[model samples]
Target: MTGALQADLPIYDVRRPVLRLRPAKAWRHFQNLMKDKENTEEVFHIFESLPWRNLRPSAERFLRSARGQALRMREPNLPAILDDHAALRQMPAGSLAHAYCDFMEREGLTAQGLVEEFDRFAKHHVQFQDQFRWYLNRMRDVHDMLHVLTGYGRDALGESCVLAFTYSQQPSPAHLFIGYMAGLNIRRQVRSDAPVLKAVTEGKRLGKACPRLCEQSITELLPLPLEEVRRKLNITPAMHYREAHRTWAEMGVDPYDLLGKKLQKAA
Candidate 1:
């Protein structure tokens, strides 16, 4: 918020050919993704439906920042760096890089997989300047890394909370909408006392207070202990999220698969 987006704080201040919001299309994509959670392309389509003001302005500012200049100078491929498990494994124990590597290995995920998922949508084919693309790719590449930093798992609630947190950092309406909808659905469907909305809202608050992780280099943060990294990033423990999880457990609701099962039945 301080750098790329701060040039104009107002929503209307935008470049030519403003990306208009298509609520109906975004809703359809959301429905398709909710019904079949594996359809990751729908997620990208949702973002496209409610596109950002041309990032040209953001790109202009990004190019002026130190991190932006460093990225441009080296032209490091973020996904490639994340995929290099060998190199990441060499990071010190308890480091963010090591935890991230472990999480990726356990989840059988790769940064490249997210890129491939977005590519399958085919709607992101619009031409963008290299700096704009770099800025865009940087956001996409940090999705899983966010999970690690925020202490959020890949479960349904975790994903929702992370999105809420992301909205606070990036101020993306789509992210907030999805997080709100997801939290609503979970609370309505799950027979539990879990404070779903409270947890998600807390995520947003935490994110608003935390520093912009996108402004920092992944490699630079990788070598530090996770706690140190979190401290530097101003991320606090997710008290509400942990409390909600405990309540869900007490009520015998499986947070991981609860939404899928309920949604499939509703459909």
Candidate 2:
């Protein structure tokens, strides 16, 4: 099989990357966050302050526990995820994105001009300088495929729930947990209702029930040209795209804006 095609394949690893953090570096990050605690607290506080809230304490506890599992796990799925992304980048221009756009168009999820957005960004942005941009793009690109796999929607709540699941299963501290927390905050802001909150809680709980099951779900539902067992889920590309767009838009702001800049500075 060609390397490009192999990008969609599942990867199982028993180890995670270790960061040898200098105390000073860690302290800087902590202080920066502390300085902006109000903004961060506001988002999370939304969850705590909501009425008709059905985010069970059990579910919340489960998500926290899952986060702990991710932290303690030896190896996360970063290598595999990055490998898949590199493979996608190698495909012909009209290949993967076209497939995604076609799927979205057929589902009435996005307008015809959608591909242009990606094209525009790809043309103007040298992703190498901004690894975070590359990360964001990879996240956006595969996001719909993930939805097709997991049967989640594009809403703030649904996406956050799936992210929490992804973080639990994959255990990537840099991307997974940060994204999960952001999604949780955004979901709380947008939909504080009982059903929405319940879905979020249930998604996390189900994620905790079987991390391997969740990972397999991601592998199976990816919209790649693979012969893996396909299970029909309730999610659609449009829904996933919509939710991803919302979440990333929020991430485009100040502190998070520095994500790409940080990588550039380090480089």
Write one digit per residue (lDDT tens) for candidate 2, span 95-209. 4333444445455553213333455534643323211222222333344544444555544445555655554444434223334454555544443223433444455555454
* Reference-based TM-score of each model: 0.87, 0.33
The list of candidate 1 runs beyond 4 A from truth reads 1-17, 259-267
Candidate no. 2 TM-score: 0.33
Misplaced by over 4 Å in model 2 are 1-17, 20-142, 173-180, 187-192, 208-267
Give the number of the best model, judged by TM-score: 1
Sliding window of 10 residues with minimal summed lDDT for model 2: 46-55
Give the CA lDDT, 0 to 100, for residue 254 in model 2. 27
